[model samples]
Target: MIKAKDGDFFISDWLRNVNTLEYLSAWETMNNPDFNYGEYAIIRQSSGTNTFKISVKEWVLKTNSIGITAQAGRYGGTYAHKDIAFNFGMWISPMFQLYIVKEYQRLKTIESDTLNLEWDIKRVLSKVNYHLHTDAILKHIIPKSTLPESKKGIEYAKEADLLNLALFGCTAKEWREANPAHAKNNLNVRDFASIHELNVMSNLQVFNSEMIKKDVSKTARYKILLKSAQEQLEQLKKIDILKAVRKQNSATYIEARNKTGDELEKLTSESILDKNKQALSDFNKKLKQGLNYNPKDEK
Candidate 1:
């Protein structure tokens, strides 16, 4: 159209077509309840006539249409919504439209993969920190007794909710109740936490574990953990470390790190499981040795 018109101002001519005007007006009416039907009727009546005319700017200004825009500058041109742009592209060339579709799909795939990878990394970090947190509870909070196994699990859950309340200001059950839709999707409060929150949560786990070993009261521990969470979150916001970490942990960086046999390759569920198991085994072994040894015999 521009080649035949011998100018770069063909979109205004295209916008004046009878079918294009009607379709755009109908789209506006369907999508925007506040569409100006009065002005649309005046434009519609003049369509298909030699006197009919409308620029993208005039259409937008008169009818509040958002489907198209006109700009004036060296870097500016008429821009349309993707739906309208694709239709115009098809009108211009079918092959060009097909290429646009292919390229759009490719970009979408890359975006989806990157997002999935980041989610996976954060989930893994949360889970690993959770294991360490639980280990602390087992070692310090759960008393060694012949009590039923069910009671032990209950203690663990109760302590877990204490951390949940301290960091998230709600128990797990409370979160589930408030967000039944997310609960149905198998998500929890921590799963939706921001990167900074997750970082604070990780720090809280270690801090809480140390407090547990010190035999701090649950009430006291809650205050300490909550204060730490606030302080660390504020500190994290002041720094760009999280952004740098995200870039370093990106899919491209991870792939390169894996090929080079760097430490990033160790961030796997299996590796986490093995590390937890080894830690637990060592804890139990040391417990048994401590129980068997007698310091008085050495004296």
Candidate 2:
């Protein structure tokens, strides 16, 4: 939300309280140094509007917006939920309300584009380096002259999670810790990952696979890999994304133990306007050199 004239901008859920009288009184009192303390503004719960005035404290308690510094003063103004703020803006001017919506939507587009660029870089990096990791598996983890245990792919599954753990310092389950809107949210902490972190993670997959068949105990292997991941990721923690695209292509991709031909093909995307797209492609090809899946033939 933005009130350019008032020089206010905040991004969070809008606040609207149908059961309380706080909003109206607060709006009415804006910019008033001697704002009366006995005022309130309660919206009708049924209609979600139709506000009526009441006592201030009751309004505060009912709406749960009472604060240490009750009113927004020199520090711009009292903080309110986006909804309440929008309501205030509307009260201030219909033109202000439209401005708020326009500015908010514009900010969202900028945020979404920035996030997609970051995800694309990570996704592309993951693809290019994938074959290297898989090659490590085929050359080291696979049994020699024998088929390994085939009861279930759990061991292989664990290795895949290990790759994830190495790269991101957590399993997919851990990735979802906040359980953010799995798809609804377009940007997240993961979206902020650095290119260096993604690179280290790709190499770690190969390193983990190589260790799996080297008789290194899982505990020892995990510790080594985790330590490497931690130390490397430490560098990325400081990445500056004042530098950091486009549509998400409306499809989600899953991390893999192994990629199918179709999956690889699906991963390829049309180039954005970036001049470096070809370089990124060549770089990707080198990364996945030894992988079994052929991205070009993927559906």
Candidate 3:
């Protein structure tokens, strides 16, 4: 589009204008912490004169600007931030600028849709396998007549926490304590799990289910689950799925509802199981059947 408008020459014309320079300087100020304001001031003072001319390269070198970049190589080209690029497009013509904006929005919508579809597919697969895991638990792990109605979910929580510990190095309760803000919103650890983690977790569910059917003890099954989680996670890390997809930004969504930066950062980071000593001890005791099972207290 720029080539058709003869923008190659227009770049210098664009830079000579005081308005263009001011916009570029303002963008740099906002985005570039190390922008050389002293040099920018000198350039601004010299603006709007026939004698005043600056190339993209000259502007970058003079002001430590990051709003635009120039490189000299086969893949090299003058690139500007979207704001500056759009402004340059407007310099070409309003119609051209409109086209760029619309095309950008179209592409972004397609990208967002594709990512959402991918995430939904992964989530569905995880849910299906989770149902299978729970079914196996019902048939094999939970005793039908040996426990009361209120205690049935205790075994479910225990098995679920077993997978949680294997994959996340934490129990469900531990995850909740460490992420109180998310807990307040009724979000769980898996709700914030990355695509790769979800994929590995889906497989872990199947493995755990099969082991349960074979009457594997909790301790024995946990060792196998942990090994599989680590190995699968390491292998999945080599895949490029993370680049194409991200954990749904549920944390960011929650943060947007008047949450602070500190809480947002904490939400995004991994929660250590050992962060709360009391919770860890409780989890250990539960695993050893030392704590009374309470289905009403299910997380």
When sorted by lDDT, best at the front, the candidate numbers are 3, 1, 2
> Least accurate stretch of 10 residues (summed lDDT) in model 3?
252-261
| Model 2 spans with C-alpha error above 4 angstroms | 1-89, 92-94, 143-158, 165-199, 206-221, 242-299
lDDT of candidates 1 onward, in order: 0.64, 0.49, 0.71
Candidate 3: stretches off by over 4 Å: 1-12, 16-18, 34-86, 93-96, 144-149, 241-243, 248-299
Q: How accurate is candidate 1 locally (lDDT)?
A: 0.64
Clashes per candidate (backbone, < 3 Å): 0, 13, 0
Query: Mind giving the per-residue lDDT tens digits that candidate 3 earns over 123-215?
Result: 675575777786787678766425444344455666776777777766666667778889788777778888777888889889999998888
TM match of model 1 to true structure: 0.61
Tens digit of lDDT per residue, candidate 2, span 1-299? 35455644332112334422345445535634444453332233322444523333344555443331234447643455555556756754679769988999999998988887777778886676566655555555554413323311123334555655445544444444444466235343335455776677676876776775676655566667877877876875676544543233322233322333343222211111111445444433543473343323211
Q: How do the residues 7-80 of candidate 1 rate in per-residue lDDT, one tens digit apiece?
A: 36467677778878888887787788877889888888887888778888889888888777888999978887
What order do you get sorting by TM-score, best first? 3, 1, 2
lDDT of 1 at 292: 24
Relative to the true structure, candidate 3 reaches a TM of 0.65
